[model samples]
Target: MQLTQSSSVEIPMNDAKEVDSVTLEPVDSQSGMDGGLKAWLTVVGGWIAGFCTFGAANSFGVYQALYTLEGTSSASNISWIGSLQLCLIFAMGILTGKLFDAGYFHHMQIAGMLLYVFSHFLLSP
Candidate 1:
């Protein structure tokens, strides 16, 4: 009853006491996670991604300063922009983090990238 990447299954016939085992192959073969090429690439990529995300998160002060200089909005009202950005990031992280844990990483990654590009185009003047 145990299933693995290359495990087999046993089927018993109604009229016979013999059992037949059917070998199964995994749909996709994964690169080793034990310090393999994929693992190193993932580590590097994650570092870069973390750098970008945190870098943007930390730049909110610059944005708030600029907004305050503009005099078009109060400092408190301008603060909401940064607050909303962080809120969306953490909220989406919760949903996307679960998707990653559930092994829908590629699906989520594609959807996220598409959404990012689409939003850029949408919000651009």
Candidate 2:
């Protein structure tokens, strides 16, 4: 005669296996409209400013050639002018970034705008 024993174990259902109704947050209809307007305004403003400042700088090659002609200025000396300008522009970016990180964007932007206007006026000669 032989005796045999059987063991029974209960398995629990996985939490993910249970199907429950999901509720989604409602979307705001005006959200897209508001964001689009703001984005477009920023893009337009940037384009205007870029064209006025950077676009003007791109025309520097024409001016440099004229300045480097005989009786005006030596090419070697005139080349330094552009180098100094680029150096100053890049250096100012460092300071501006620091100021912006400190939440001084408005002041920095105002100062930059004023400086840009003043420089252009002074160089208008």
Candidate 3:
């Protein structure tokens, strides 16, 4: 019943003419399946990232209104900016997903935060 390296089992068929062979390997018990502190931390970090990114993007209407009131830009032009922001968010999600699958999640996370902060600094007068 115990499976180890290169361990295989054979089962006899009802007709006793053919046998089916199956190979089994022992599953790693500690392959990050504990769902403990690390899992919860990752969940919370994702929630925070979503809040910072999506939250600001979704609130573009307020910014657009302010811009319109200040007469800095036309309503249509301001709306276009909001649309572009949403599109970039979606497009970047695809790129980021690829990087995540490639195991550069921590690097991307750090780079994203730095970029976010740097952008805010550039935007500040």
Q: Which candidate's TM-score is highest?
A: 3
Best by lDDT: 3
Over 4 Å off in model 2, which ranges? 1-34
lDDT of each candidate versus the true structure: 0.74, 0.70, 0.80
Clashing residue pairs, backbone N/CA/C < 3 A, model 2:
none
TM-score of each: 0.59, 0.61, 0.69
lDDT, candidate 2, at 97: 83
Q: Write the per-residue lDDT of candidate 1 for residues 83-123, one digit (tens) a residue.
A: 88778888888888888999998898788678756754853
lDDT of 3 at 104: 100
Error of 2 at 122 (Å): 2.7
Once model 1 is optimally superposed onto the true structure by TM-score, how far is the C-alpha of residue 14 displaced, in angstroms?
Answer: 32
State in Å the error of residue 10, model 3: 10
Q: What is the clash tally of candidate 2?
A: 0
lDDT of 3: 0.80
Candidate 2 yields a Cα-based lDDT of: 0.70
For model 3, residues 101-121, the per-residue Cα lDDT tens digits are 999989998998898889768
Steric overlap count per candidate: 0, 0, 0
Estimate the TM-score for candidate 2.
Answer: 0.61
Off by over 4 Å in 1: 1-34, 117-125
